[model samples]
Target: MKISAAARFRRALLIGAAALASLAPLAPAQADGLPDPGFQIVQGQTALLVTDPQNDFLSPNGVAWGVVGKNVEANGTIGHIDQLFAAAKSSGMPVFISPHYYYPTDHGWRFEGALEALMHHIGMFDRKGQLTTEGFEGSGADWLAQYKHYINDGQTVVTSPHKVFGPETNDLVLQLRKRGISKVIIAGMSANLCTEAHMRELLEQGFEVMVVSDATAAAQLPGMDGYAAALANFRMIANHVADTGTVVGAIRANHHK
Candidate 1:
């Protein structure tokens, strides 16, 4: 039987489509949509997100210490975040670190909001410009030493720096989407600010979020308890809120499938 040229073209198209479909699930969660609006985070479809694990937020000698030292110590945030990373690795889950940094140019803005102005004055999370690595080695912008193994390891991904409090200010959503992550297990510093902002924005973007409560801390001032305020919102907005132990157990249970 003689086949028409147009018929041969159609046959080629179908063959190409099937080949593409087979390559879609590169890292699991190959489907674009979430299982449901409310999601149960499993080993394959979710990532562990730790934000602003920078020295400025986690170290006692950091500039922001005067504000967060007590809370950070009391909450044991450093150790908890470390544990979360360890468990995520054990379960073979992808880990994403969202960092915060500002350059010299960031300080020169004429009109700044209260927190922005304050951060500039305090020199918090300050690293040299994108071109220079100065002050980044041991400065407040550096990651906590305890987490070096995890963050520096080739497997973990560090997303583009977030200038403001939310993931919208960075490539976080892009990285997550590309990796087929439909859910996030999140914990990090500054609960009321960065952590909460990430939660709010991720939820709005339709990613199910489970917060590790004790793995995050907030700066407490005389009038406001930052952690306290963030806790209320996390409980109400996040798909789930639990401690490191609980989340680690769940991750382990779901692993190796």
Candidate 2:
């Protein structure tokens, strides 16, 4: 027996509905064609990429203190980054530290950019040598004591040290890719420099990035407000720009739910 024309149309419509239903769960669909524009902290696929959480940037007694101290204090950057670490730990998200450390030979380079020359001149983030896994103590290259427990050996994934600015100079991208992390939640020093560089590079590499704005600080200059400039760029290009509290809340919800 042959099927009726109306019956064939109904069968085709059912098959089309089933095909769409299968594809629906492949990726999230937003009504307005907007990327999930809300805070999305994917539990295991997203890792926290904190750049240069070191004494030179976060502590009062370090070399960059003169430049970044006031902003650090005003923004409570130290506590905010710590808060992010704590939440990531509780939520079981990978915490990757992309540190900046300069060795003795780095200062010997004859040619340097403005910030590179300035950092060498100021003796910022100067480590004795790169041969040791143990970082220096009470030095510009050291991790703030408050963060040792979290970033210590075997406790966290510390990517290769980046000499100048971004994750491109280090193994950060490699580590993230190896761990299947395609989304990064970033925070840490000099909002316009390293943190901004991380954001730019990660986006170029096709990863979705969210920046914790208040968890990072920047050096204030006579006319240039570094953090403000970074915040603007993050708002324009990042998948999301959120504060510490907002991030922490999302982390909790993602992990617990």
Query: Each prediction's TM-score against the native?
Result: 0.83, 0.84
- Model 1 CA lDDT for position 148: 91
Candidate 1 lDDT by residue in tens digits, 184-245: 99999789999999999999999989899999999899999999999988877887788889
TM-score of decoy 1: 0.83
Alpha carbon lDDT of each predicted model? 0.86, 0.87
Taking every candidate in turn, the Cα RMSD to the unseen true structure, in Å, is 11.0, 7.7
Model 2, range 1-257, lDDT digits (tens) per residue? 99999999999999998987776675345564434354576767899988999988888888888888998999889999999999999889999999998888888898988999999998898887888645588788889999999998476999888878888889999999999999999999889999999999999999999999899989889998888899888877788888899999989888888
